[model samples]
Target: MSFIHLDRPDCPEAHRPEAHHPDRKLTARKLITRTGSSPPVHCGHVAMVTRVTKNMSAKAKQSNKSADKNANDRNDVASKESDAEKANPQWKLISHEQINTLLDLTVEQVQFQFEEILGLKNYQTCLKEASLLDYFVSGFWWTREMNYTCQQISFIMALLQFLLDNISEKQMPFVDNLNEFAKMISGTRQSPSPEVDSLFDAEQAMSITDYLKCSLFQNYQLYEFLFSQPREELLLGKKVRLPASLCPYVC
Candidate 1:
């Protein structure tokens, strides 16, 4: 009996067994010889790549959020510090012992004098006025000693001249009393007797250098002693007012 050789290499196409289905037909040789991947494996690889890309995108978004939040936090802190500075204008220096010695008084005595000069019923008000005076006087001394520009020196000198003019015109009791107290402490004239007209005339053509020679600038220690206290202590209970004429220069 003759038997059919199905697995022979020279098998005829017409006589060979047909594949199970056209779409599903595949052989080990065909799979190995193909240059591209199979559908199932390709889909799985694409899905893995997509998942990795999504994870990277998520991480990037999270990093951006963290950066934004940190920026906001820094800005908030800066804003708060700025607000605090504005709300409370304080003296830059605080050498209590030096100030006491300069004034020839104890801390307690300085406080008392401040209260008396400002006519402050509350202790806190005295401290605030003292700090303000310190800031003003220190600014003046620094500007003078550091050789500030002529324009800058002139502006400050003009402001001071304005304040002095106002004090004389208003006859502010606090300034008069403070001047007297300063004179007593220094054993030198703090200012010309209040009766002696104007120390500086806005209309005058005097130089800033000439203005500095006046008693106000000469007796700077009086002001430094006034502002030695803490700023918060100064504004605890009262409102301080700048002279109306000086308001334009302040802002």
Candidate 2:
């Protein structure tokens, strides 16, 4: 007798369920059936998993965009700061005490020349007629104009000598500060030439006066501040006598 064996390896092929196709889409029903779980529970879990995956991808993209924006903002801020720093350079200013000290030193240095001018034969007449104060403030004598006498020229040259002797890199911390202060006071558009060592050399004859003229003509702001603008303390109690007209401005 030929009896059919359902549990044997030789069981009929038509009786076994078909194998799942590799390319077939996996659905909630298929998953639940494969796992031997309830359809409702597995379908809900699958939907939640899909939603969670989409949310995570969106969050990652949002985080990346936020990071990019933050980086750009920082770069922008840094660039602006750099531009601001470049636009406005840092400058140091001389103190009031330093100015006072410089004035005193200058007067002390030029005392001999001042006396020499006063000793001139026509000193009184020149002081009355010529703008002696203006000449001193200008620190230069235009021989062509012949407005100032030899005495006035000598005095201005002496003051220029004092300035050349005193204002040195060794004497002052920042020489450019003094130069910049001069520029601000003069309201001049041109800047002075860079301070030169040869101009300050003691061996150079009349180089000090030349340097002073160059500086003043290039930027008269400093000259105005030092001499034209009156300061009570500048020559107070000093034997230096200014013209009656200038006494109000200087005394």
Best by TM-score: 1
Off by over 4 Å in 1: 1-41, 95-251
Report the alpha-carbon TM-score of model 2 versus the true structure.
0.27
- For residues 1-251, write the lDDT of model 2, one tens digit per residue: 88876556666743554332456655777778888884465778889999999999999999999999999999977875564333222211223333233343444343334334434344344432123334442343232133433322333344444443333222432355456434322321222223312112232224433545566445444433344333323432457767899888883
lDDT (Cα) of model 1: 0.48
Error of 1 at 82 (Å): 0.5
- Each prediction's TM-score versus the true structure: 0.29, 0.27
Enumerate residue pairs that collide in model 1.
128-234, 130-227
lDDT measured at residue 159 in model 2 versus the true structure, 0 to 100:
44
Which 10 residues in a row give candidate 2 its minimum summed lDDT? 196-205
